[model samples]
Target: MSSTTTSITCTGLTFGWPDGTPVLDGLDLSVGPGRTGLIGLNGTGKSTLLKLIAGELTPLGGAVRVTGELGHLPQNLTLDTSLRVDEALGVADARAALHAIEAGDAAEEHFTAIGDDWDVEERARATLDQLGLVGVGLDRTVGEVSGGESVLLRLAALLLARPDVLLLDEPTNDLDREARQRLYAAVSAWPGVLVVVSHDRELLGLVDRIADLRPDGVHWYGGNLDAYEEAVAAEQEAAERMVRVAEADVKRQRRELTESQSKLAKRVRYGNKMSANKREPKIVMNQRKRDAQVSGAKHRLLHEQRLEDAKERLDEAAEAVRDDAEIRVDLPFTAVPPGRRVLTLRDVELRCGARATLDVHGPERIALLGRNGSGKSTLLRTIAGGLPAVAGEVETHVPVRSLPQRLDVLDDDLSLVENVARLAPEATNNRVRAQLARFLFKGARADRTVGTLSGGERFRATLAAVMLAEPAPQLLMLDEPTNNLDMASVRQLVAALGSYEGALIVAGHDVPFLRDIGVTRWLRLDGELNPVDPEEV
Candidate 1:
């Protein structure tokens, strides 16, 4: 918990994947005590940088230096189902040793194991409780807890270790509202050198600073996400102004060069005419012509150099501006009348044995909230007709499409156009290509195999395929739509869904994102589907 020392530093760091795709090249960074939020678009090496710092990955070049012990929580956490909570917390041995010593065992090994950490069990329990794991006993097995609980449990283990530095990657991806609050509290209280890579806006808001990773390197910004955005916006505005001024300067230089050339030519013609009319000596005429030619050449060179300088300035100004593209589309056919019935659940029994009867009218946007393994996804699949209901009936009055969390709707071997064409068999290839372009996969990008696309690109492609299907799906169901997406892609998804006029049933734990997308109704799925207030969620 000391705050006076540097925790992590990388000097001339470089790394690349096995396929020779360069990620970080000669990158340098240093971190001190307090929390720093690491953010960037998908495939920008945010996670990769964390791994390098944690020594989980060895850099191809340069060196990483850590001042103290470090602990890391990966994005995709997996634990043995048979592992006990104490074992996962890394305190099982110490706890057993302490109990054995108390039971009158004089074994030197137990004493040695207990060492100076005689209060390990108490610390572990306190850490777990701090993370909102009140009822989860240390003796409980990993399989007895939910996925969100597992995440917090792992974090508890790291906290118990009391390392001087910590790294967390997307720690709140599957956490519900209450669990997220617990995480926010933990982050706010962390006193060590903490660097977290996340797209969760609320989580990022707790950080003391932001580290934006780019192709060139990492750029530091003061304050949290909102401050960083405001600063960047102001910078972009100034850059644009500079570009405009540079452009005008270039235009003026070009015009002046053209006018000067015209005047020089006219003067040369007049001088020649006067010299010939006056019948001057041949040597004098030749000297005058040579002088005129030299003067014209010098004038042209000066103007051309000025024009080149202006162009270079313009190029630099343009580079300062960020021009990231956004997805914009119009799906008029997907709209439905307010009074039209879109879906009906007649005593429908979910795959998890939950029964619910409900009617969805028009384009009602519903936000499904639940903890991990609460069957939010199961209900969505059942409604989408991807899964058979255990009992009762699910009736859909319009075309339904589901975008699963796994994004398995598209074939990896096929191109984006081909995938969309497969979903909409009636649409011609040209039409499909045109629609795909609207999703930001223009021309050749649409032809690239899905396997070649990045995580964000794949999500966009999957969304495009589902939304562009034939009959124009009037009912769309999405499961954990924001999982693993970068902030930019999340914004793009929100924008795209904003334009969607279809009935939406999105199951996700991202509360801020759900609110931003304008959810008309909020429903919580526990043992049954029931309406809940947005504030409760």
Candidate 2:
């Protein structure tokens, strides 16, 4: 990949949904040869922008131009399950041609197909291995790999293509810890123009720059996530200070307006009294009255304008400060005694060939960690009763609820209020609305159908339904809860989890998040459950 020449540029870009919901408008961006992290809240058009650049979707206006060949890995990847690994990687024809030539078929077409890439097979295998696809062979079907591995396989395909420009959307969302490390390495080594939209902090830290998408426009920051955060924090502080100054000016202007009005009224009263007492000539008194009225009116207008100007300044300053609200809730009923048994898994053998016996007591917070295809999600599903275990007993002493990675708990056609109501039938409408409000879905927001909600909104609604279910789940399980969530949404999840006083079994690759939620026990699955030190993970 060339380092100096490749680039992606968008000019006067504008886009809107079919329903007339506008997204980007007159947006212009220039990405040079380097790793750039694209980040924003869910629905801020990070993915949409990537799609436009990748030519997956046409913009409503303007144009996108790339200086070199491009490869894209979208957030939602759909590949044919019957496709062979080599076919999915787009090397099946070349591989076949090379084999035919090696078998002594000296055909012109085979030679053309093989071209100068005689080492295509070795490169493919090496790319696979580099991405931690050790056992995944070219002959294996796509259906034979796990979901996380499938993501890596697609990334491997992109890498083998060797395009000068690459775009990845939430690439690590499906990857496990080890696979994410491999991806981080690939991203670090990318020498051409690269733009990735991701919520993974570790992945963002590998970038040379950050493109933060906001409603106003894209704001560029020089460095990684931490650097962007520090820059933003300083900006917020300055904005806040400006807001305070503007507020004080507004107050002062209001006070001055009031004082002027008071003084004007007093003058009016004195003039009337003088006129009534005949203290001066009639004509002179009339002239004095007229002049006083005109001066007072001018003074009042000036003060009112000052107040208005101050208010406008205050509004402007306030706009500069972000309001990323977090979730806050109290779930006292979900609390468990210190000695109570929450869950017991006896000799549990998952369908993915992992076996473990686990006992969760009290409010133990457990982190389930593993590589891709290591059966973490499988074990979670088995314990959640969504999948039957191959062997052994799974029991929960208290009510259990699982928040799956896909967030399939809610009906898309139904509104959030309706979904939560279905799960908590005994709760009154007002009660459900109150709780939903805490989840940041207030009033009409809660009435919107789940299908219309954004990823973050859907996550919050699903979590609300599960945690606020009728029986009050004292044992909660979440699988990859932060997979596609934005940073704000991740913080909201942490805040919501903070209020849950129940035993938790969270299976995820986000170690920072797991630690933030206070995971008391670290368990790694590798054909068996093994205790891992928190520091090691």
Candidate 3:
């Protein structure tokens, strides 16, 4: 916690995948005690950097140094279902020792275990309560908690440790609104060196600074995400201006070169006439021709070099400007009539015992809001016919498609084009490939197997397959659609959703994403489907 000391440092750090794809090359970073938000596009090694700092991954070269104890919360955290709360918090032994002593056991080993941490249980409970896990008891098993609760429980464990350096990657990916708020509060109150990599704007707003990771290295920007964005915007504006100026200079130089060539050609024709008519001495004519040739060559070389320099400057300026592409596709076939009923749930009982009675009409876009394990996904799966309802009847009057959180819609061994073709058998190979290109998979990229694609790419492929099915789904249901997606992918999803003319029922924890997709109604799932205001969500 010293003002002058750095908590984590990396010097000449290097790492790459087994396929020799370099992620970080000779990267040097130094982090002091404060909250720092690490951000970049997907596959930019943001998570990989955190793992190296936490010693979870070994770097190919160089070194990572930490001044004090470090704690890390990974993006995909899986805990044993049988693990008790106290054990997960790392206080089981201390709690056992304290209990044995209180019961009059007085064993030497018990006393040794207690050491000076007799208040560990109290601290653990207090930490859990701070993270909004109020009713969760130490004796409870991991399976008894919801997905959001499990994430908070892991964060609670990290808080109890009180490590000097803390690293969190995509901490709010699966958290509901209330849980995300609790996490934001915890991050604001932390008094150590904390580095978090997340796409959640609200979470990034809590950081004191931003560390933008790029292929070259990390670029530091003071203040939170908004501040960083403003700075980058200004930088991009300047870069654009530079590019324009460089382009104009190149054009002007080319014009000058052309004019010089024309003048030189005229002079050569006049000189040839003078030599043929004997208008000058032979030696003078030969000397004059030699001089003109040398001058012309030098002039052309100078102009060409200037044009090349201008082009290089233009390229560099363009590189400074970010170009994040969005998905653009139209699915007119998915449109439904205004009076048509897309889906009907007739007193339906979900797999998780939740009941619902609703009718979705026309192109209504519904946002399903609920805490983790609240049966939102179950209802979507039931409607998609992936799971049978416990009781009652569910009917869909139009073509339906469901995109699950696990992204299992495509075959791992099949190429992206092949996957789309399988979903829409009537569409020819050329047609499928053309549609896939709009999803940002062009040519060779479209031929990549599903298993070899990155998380964002895989999501795009799955979405493409669902939306481009043979029947063109009129009732589309998505479960946690934004989970594990990068910001670019999320924007692409929003773009795709904006063009859909069919009914939509998307269950997710991302409020910003839901709002961006133009949700017409908000429904909260508990024991039944209840209408709620978007503000409440």
What C-alpha lDDT do the candidate models reach, one value each? 0.88, 0.90, 0.88
User: Which consecutive 10 residues in model 2 have the weakest lDDT in total?
Assistant: 1-10
Q: In model 3, where do residues sit more than 4 Å from their true spots?
A: 408-433, 443-455, 469-471, 535-537
What tens digits encode model 1's per-residue C-alpha lDDT throughout 1-537? 457777899999998866455778999999998899998887778878888999999999999999988999987688898999999999999999999999999899998988999889889989888888999999999998877789999999999888889999989877877888999999999878899988888999999999998888888999999999998889999999999999999999999999989989998998889786978887888888899899999999999999999999999999988766677768899998999999998878886667777789999999888777688878888888788998888999999999987788999988788899998999998889889988888888788788756566777899999999987889999887887678888988899899999999999988789998999999888888899987766
Q: Clashes in candidate 2: how many?
A: 0
Model 2: how far is 428 from its true place, Å? 4.6
Provide the lDDT at 295 for model 2: 100
Q: After TM-score superposition, what is the CA distance of residue 230 in candidate 3 from its true location, in Å?
A: 0.9
Per-model RMSD to reference: 3.1, 2.0, 2.3
TM-score of 1: 0.89
Query: Which ranking of candidates, highest TM-score first?
Result: 2, 3, 1
lDDT for residue 422 in candidate 3, whole number 0-100: 88
**Model 1 score (lDDT):** 0.88
Q: Residues 215-303, candidate 3: write the lDDT tens digits.
A: 88999999999999999999989989988988898899889889988888998999999999999999999999999999988988988
Error of 1 at 352 (Å): 4.2
lDDT of 1 at 513: 90
